[model samples]
Target chain A: MVKIYIPADTTACALGADKVAAEVALQAQKRGLDVELKRNGSRGAFWLEPLLEIESGEDRFAFGPVYPGDVAGLLDAGLHESSEHPLFLGRVTDIEWLSRQDRLTFSRAGVIDPLSLDEYRREGGYEGLDKALAMTAGEIVEAVTDSGLRGRGGAAFPTGIKWRTVLNTPSDQKYVTANADEGDSGTFADRLLMEADPFQLIEGMTICALAVDATQGYIYLRSEYPKALQVLNQAIAIAEAANLLGSDICGSGRDFHLQIRVGAGAYICGEETSMLESLEGKRGLVRFKPPLPAIEGLFGEPTVVNNVLTLAAVSTVLAKGAAYYQDYGSGRSRGTLSVQLSGNIRRGGLVEIPFGASLRELVEDFGGGTASGRPVRAIQVGGPLGAYLPESQWDTPLDYEAFTDVGAMLGHGGVVVFDDNVDMLEQARFAMEFCAVESCGKCTPCRIGSVRGVELIDKIGKNDGRSANLELLEALCETMDVGSLCAMGGLTPMPVRSALKHFPGDFERGTGNGIER
Target chain B: MHSSGEAPAVIVSSAVRKFADTPGGLLPLLHEIQAGLGFIPSDSVVTIASGMGLSRAEVHGVISFYHDFRDKPGGQKTIHVCRAEACQAVGSRQLEAHVKTRLGVDYGETTVDGRFTLEPVYCLGNCACGPSVRIADDVFARVDADRFDELLGDI
Candidate 1:
């Protein structure tokens, strides 16, 4: 029997992996091999997923990010012989990128078929819920606290503290919200996770509901990810059918229901308050603090809002015990982070590793250098709004505190690499333009500042404009940073300033001033 | 906002009615209605407002808010060049300018021939292949101005 495992990660699906699975099944059958084509989650090496694993004597031989058309070539190479092609050149475990990751949340990510609840259970999916069900709510919170799991949504907020607040808050309609709006540029970890092992996210959220005594949860997904929404919705359906969701989850009498809410083309909605606003079917405008979402969220009730990764990690901690998950990472940042490497890079996709891994290892070793093959000049860590660190900062570790200490926030764990050919000035302008377009425009700083930022950057790019406008630009960034209601306006300056600071040479004034033309 | 002055009430039809009751109905409904009926009609605006129990101004604000939603009919073909970070990293700006010069219209404006409408988008998630543009539902990756011509030539 030729049992082939195809990772069900969304990016793999986008690359037509599902069809490849069917092709593998058909091809294997034609070859007279008993083919059990199972769709598993990605192993986080996304560049290598739809990664087809064929069962060998002791272990499964891997080939990857495979396409339906590649099935013939794969078989022609002698599937029975297995280890002789460029596709399966490396050992799956020896890939330092995957090996270094202490995957608590992502444990079942690339292992089991995302759609099959049976495979999910076999790989220890709902074991977290079982463990959480045995413990009291306080014990559940304490275990999570001891695990030292921080929010992977980029905020690095203590997951336990956030849960505890919602737990302690007296409200009949407390909610567990998963910010599946993985809107950050170059980050597809959430989408990959949801597509690969959606049950992990479900199981995680289920455990949260049980721990916090909440009956309802929502996964707010970005509209750009239409396929992920489909996969997640289907997974949710399967979960509900298997008594893993809705009332009496895992037959524990804990009532939890999950609804997938689609985002309407707004990047700011990725933020907690804005997501809440979007969930309420209003404009995705950021709300003021003091009335935190933990106190009054999603129609004026206490809510436990977390990133998809955060909730998914909860399942691992609960299932394998907190200490197991906590054993990885550096001082403050514990556990592995699914870092998404994208942009101008040879190998682009998710790389789940311990929190303290250096950027050098991620970009050079795992990323395999830039797609353009030029010398690496600047790299934008985090998302579009993240800082553009020069090669000097390449050695910095991928941790929340480390990134923050150096004026960069590891927002959503997306590391977008850029080569020497990258024009930082243009990048800064694009950041402003992005914020301007996606801004909910609820606040003036973002609304006006973003538009102004574009104009000012354009002027700076032009040599005729006064250099004094640079100060004006800085002042505008300060105004937006302090005055803006949300990160949409506030953090937009991070990339802009970083671009101007790191690659000032790229921003030099030429003859006509505005682009090379 | 269309000056075609054809029929005024062709905007919000049955599709809008079907989607108006959905959880996140407004945007998709308007997009569907626009796709069916060239523009979001004044009558349909009222229909959407009444069906969704929203104010006409609120509906109008939403229509105006999103660059995607058009109160007027677009040209026969719409060419959206991704002007986002990834696309920019690989010279989409030049390609955009080239397309604009070729079509003789700026961004968000339609061609005089009514053959094309050029717009800017953030990203299509085809980062590995840069300078991407989505000509309607079909995404064209690694698109330069020259490749864009073949795409534009089709329409």
Candidate 2:
């Protein structure tokens, strides 16, 4: 009997992988061939989604972009000489997209069954937790600090420093929280990690619990991710049942239990403090600083609030020595960053590479240019809050400091490509409009300035008062940048300013790109 | 305006007990109420508010704060098209226009017969396969005009 694999990832399901998987089973049954079906998570190579793998004759053959109708052909070819067919992508590892890059956190993502504990253990999972059990809490935090692992969340705060804060804070009750509220428009790495290898996140949280001495933890996930919600619930139950998450984890006398809390569809909840408010069943509002989330968070107790990627990376940093993880990237950024290549690009998927990789290499070479084959014009690296870069800046390395120097950000590492025909003015307007819509309304600047921004940008788009409106827009942007409490308002000006700087052609009269206003 | 309808207190009792032991149980209680009854009834707001020892205004604030929690019953099917940067980087604007024309409705508005409701979502976390649409819980990707029409034809 052959063991066949199909992706059960959300993107795969969106691509009709469910129907294709069903067809594969049906076709195989008709052919009277015995086979065991295993649904695996996405390998983050979304371009080849619905990618099916078959183990045959000492090799696992891969085929992709498969549909329901193509399942019959695949069954015939897959059962016999699977690797020789046209759809054959050779070994999935040999694909240049996966091979040319480094993968640290996402190594076992698409390769293992998401719900299977045995498979997770086989892939060297939970070894970090085991290692943490033997070492002192201070030793675990030292390992993370020495490994140069910062928060993969937007802030890039040192993960070890946060655990150290919780470790040092004196409290009867403490908490460790994972910010899975991935509300950014162009980003989905957090969602992919949760949906693929959920246990990795669980294990990472457990290690945090052991280091911080916080027995209770929570994962604040967004409401839109139904698939992720289901997968996480199942994985949590499985982990708890296996004693990987229960009262006595791995017989280490450490008790780390986790719960998944859903966020109401508020983008601002992605902000750490706002997420805390939402978790407590209130209207999501931005909390004031000075009494930061590290010192007084989640019911006024010490909490370790890190992003999904940050926590996931902690597991690997502990499993492999800090030096092993630190050797991959240059500068402050260590280890591989999972870059999401999406929108308008031909080869759109997850590309995990060292931090120093060039943007041109990602957009032109790996992405294979725009899907429409049009000449590329603009690129937005990072989430929606990131600035739009022109072709001239494509050579900038993808490090945080490098992007900051360029007046851009590598937020969540989602790189969205735009072609020559794109309207910079229209894209700029959407940024303000998005901020206006998603604002928590706690701060007046984000609440009021964002609405004013849309109105001013609208006048510019309509070519009604070009010079005057542009002046007002710039002033409004300045106010928002300096006055806004959180990034929602603070960074809304990034796109608006970048568009005016780089693509001034679209802001003129009779040159509007979108349907006028 | 929401229609005044009677909701059994037993249902609210069960919903409250389901998450009563957990701290900050209002959100889960509301989710349970919505999931079980489709929409949170206007009268049931008082029931839920009292069940959680929260004021009616507080409950209403939470229910309206999030986009997903609807006060009234919606159409049978929902078509949520991505309007985020990634989808717009492609041509989802055109898809939005097509759906509006085909369905004869704008975003947040339902069809005349109430068969379908059209809405705009920022991102469905499926940015890699852009121009994505989710009809109910099932998400469809690479959804061009032809594919959308074919999907609607099946419906």
For lDDT, the strongest prediction is: 2
Q: Give the candidate number with the greatest DockQ.
A: 2
Model 2, CA-based lDDT: 0.86
Grade the docking of candidate 2.
medium
Model 2, B38-128: lDDT tens digits are 5677877887777777899998989888877777777778788888999998899888899889999998888898888888888999998
**Residue B3 deviation, candidate 1, in Å?**
26
Candidate 1 residue-wise lDDT at A420: 72
- Prediction 1 global C-alpha lDDT: 0.78
Taken in order, the candidates have interface RMSDs of: 3.3, 0.9
lDDT of 1 by residue, B1-155 (tens): 34344444544556656866675567667756665655676656777888888898888877776566666667876677767665666677789889888889998888887766787766555554556776655556568888888877766
lDDT of 2 by residue, A218-250 (tens): 999987898999999999999999999979888
Off by over 4 Å in 2: A78-82, A511-517, B1-9
Task: Please state the error at residue A132 of candidate 1 in Å.
Answer: 1.4
To one decimal place, how large is model 2's interface RMSD in Å? 0.9
**What DockQ does model 2 achieve?**
0.78
TM-score of 2: 0.97
